[model samples]
Target: MIRTGTEYRDSIRDGREVYVNGEKVRDVATHPMFKPLVDIRARIHDMAHDPATRDVMTVTQNGQTNAIGNALPYTQADWWAKRRATDTVLDAVGGIVTRVGDETVGEMWSLLDGAEALAAIDPQFAPNIKAHIAKVLQADPFHVSANTDPKGDRSKAPQDQDPDMLLHVVKETDAGIIVRGAKYETAAAYANQAFTKPTIANWGDAALSDYAVGFICDLGAPGLKFICRTGFATRAQAEDYPLSNRFDEVDTLVIFDNVLIPWENVLFYRHTQAAMHIRATLHRYSAFAFVQRSLKLADMLIGAALFNVRQTGLDKLQPVQEKLAQLAVWRESLNAHLTAAIVLGERSPAGLMMPNQSLLYAGRVLACGQLHEMMHIARDLCGGQISLTPDAASFRHPDTAPWLEKYYTINDEWGAEDRRKLLAFARDLLNSDYAGHRLSFQMFAQSPPFAHLSAVYRNFDWDGPLSLVKDAAGLSDRVLGAKTLTPGDSSLSKWFATETPKGKAAK
Candidate 1:
């Protein structure tokens, strides 16, 4: 079932502890710093009920209506529908938002894929995951992800340093497990829940440990505290920093001070093998939504840069055309990977449709690894005026209005006020404080660059290339003993072997 925007706003008014900029937020929905994202999230909820977009945003299955984002993907069409729903949300919000429910909800699906392995350790884990997945559809809560603990003193173990440095089960009560520590989570100040899990680390050879725990954290739980980073929305005037004022998704360090995670919420506990499984495949499905953000970001970069150059008549230059082509190449590369992944979607052990791992991970590497460079190219195309432009107030001031107008106006087609607005937009999109922060956010949003490469290594078809080289070298049959090597069977063949519904591209 879908909720109205008002219901979502009221849900976060649970009086949970939330602080930012040395001030405690009395109401996240009304706070200036948090209101921007809260409002966008609310609008997203409303979008599902709007007649214009309701069809794209909701799906009916088994005679029950649910948010498309919460529906489990089973067919190739299901993935396409998911992609379309996310696009509809982004289009309505007018910017990229990475941590909304659609992206983080998939983490549970990944765990669903590993249910058998997790159930081996604890019989209750599998059913718990399925139940929570159902709850996501039924309750329509705003979900987020929680990883990346404070993890102080890497050189020392949790026992050697502060035990609370990494989130661990402090004790187990009859009702639930009490956990203490903190996690760096984006949008936790207002989001409903988070899939709290272990970060990627060296989990030494141990049968069981308190640190290897994963659960669904209710953000409004009694002992929870949200210590948030300063949001950009209130940092400056909205007129000059449009993107920052509207699209800044405030991040927070959520302190779990003996917070209670109910037993039913526990996805895995005291199982290092399950923790390892989670780390290995955490982004298996979620990365589709994450990388989709970069594609929109690419469009933003291209649109901002193209508009700037076209205004100044630089679009006529061949050099300018080459730079624009470079941006398009990056944009299309992401599109290709996302499209190919759906066309060759594979069926998971849980019977859900998964994007082709090799293509999806490879696309993630391209989208994240080269984001800053693309931003830089866009910044270069916007030219130095983006940095030197005066504040919007100067153009409106009576003392300087005439002077600014005379110099800023290029022709009748490009008026002074229009020029001022474009430069201000370019500044925020490329040179502002928010731009820098978002660049860093994109780079490590999923994990690190090294981890991206590791995923590609694990998923890429090495055997195809290996067999090609061995055959070219005239290797004997005994060399590959007992293993049949198809010399040039493409990776697509293996992915298509899975019994998933054929995507339109495949048919």
Candidate 2:
């Protein structure tokens, strides 16, 4: 069922223990650091009900309406609809905000893909995954992800060091399993729930280890304390740092002190095989949404740089246009990867449509690995003015207003106010401390760069290249193994042959 803005806001006021900057947060929904993003998330909910946006934000299923972002993708059309819905939210919000909900809910779908494997380990957990996937469609809770744990020592096992460093099962009762540890999660303080699970680690040969666990954690549950980092919103004026004020998704160190996880909520536990499977394929479906955000960021970078160059009539210069072209190349490269991934979508183990994993992961690497260089290009195009511009307050002051106006105003068409606003935006997007955090978020948000490359290595069809080289070099038959190796048959025609997906409600 779809929730309204008011209902979504009211749901999070569950008296969850939360703190920021050493101060106790009385109410997350109204807190200065969190309210902007909370309101943006609420707006996303309202979009599902608003008449003009409802068509784009929600879908009908079995005569019932559900959030488009929460629906399980079964066809290529489902993916397209999901993409459109996310774009609609970002466009409406006027800034990029990851971890809102859509970017994270797909992680559950990844788990669903391994239901059969999980059932082999524990039959009870298989059904739990399906139930939770359906629950997301029915309940539409604001979901986020929790994976990174603060490991005390890399050299020691979780049992040797402080066990709490990595979240572990402390005890099991008839009611549920009590867990203790912490996870670094974004937007956990204000979100309704998180798909809490183990971080990347070697599980050893043990079949059943305490660290092998995954569950749906209710954020408001007792004994969960949200210790969030100090937010950028309260640190600066909105006019000077607009993106930080409205779009900073405050990350939190959620302390799980003997928190109870109901049996029904446990997706998997004490099964290293299950844990390994999840760790391997956790981002299969979610990477699409994560990479999509980079596409949007690329657009922002292009727009800011192009506008800057054109404002000063620098677009006519050879060097400036070349820089602009370079930005376009990066932007379009991302667009190509996203569009191609959807066009050549592949079916998952569970029969759900997954974006072609190789292309999707390769796209992720290109978008993230080279983002800082592109930002530098944008920073160059925006010039020294972005860093030197005075704040809005300085422009409004009696003594300084005239001087800023005289220096900032280029022509009658470009007034002082517009120029100042543009500079402020460019500065925040590329030079502010918040900008550095965003860059880091892109680099490691989905996983580290090495992990992303590892996904590419695992998904890419290596045999195709190997066979091509073998055939060209006239290699012996034994090198081809038992089966004959053939070159891959991937092209535009193959993608075009795939059936088009129907609308969600129609399906």
lDDT of 2 by residue, 1-507 (tens): 798888989999999999999999998999999999999999999999999999998989899899999988887788889889888899999989998899899999999888888898899878888899898889899999999999889887788888899988989998889999999999999999999889987666788889989999999999999999999997998999999899999999999999999999999998888888898899988999988999999999999998888888999999998998988999899988888787677879989888889899999999998899999999999999999988999999999999999998988788999998988999999999899999999899998899999999889877767777788899976897786775542333334454344322233
**Whole-structure CA lDDT of model 1:** 0.89
Query: After aligning candidate 2 to the native by TM-score, how far in Å is the CA of 305 from where it should be?
Result: 0.6
> Each candidate's lDDT (Cα)?
0.89, 0.90
Question: What's the CA RMSD for each of the models?
Answer: 1.8, 2.3
Residue 175, candidate 1: C-alpha displacement in angstroms: 0.6
* Position 260, candidate 1: lDDT: 89
lDDT of 1 by residue, 1-507 (tens): 799999999999998999999999999999999898899889989999999999999999999999999889988889899899998899888888877789889988998999998888877778999899999999999999988988888887666788888999999999999999999999999999999998775557786889999999989999999999999997898889998998888989999999989999999998888898888899999999998989999999999999899987999999999999999999999999999898887789899899999999999999988888999999999999999988889999999999999999988899999998888888998888899989889888888889899999998888777677779998876777777687765577554464344443453
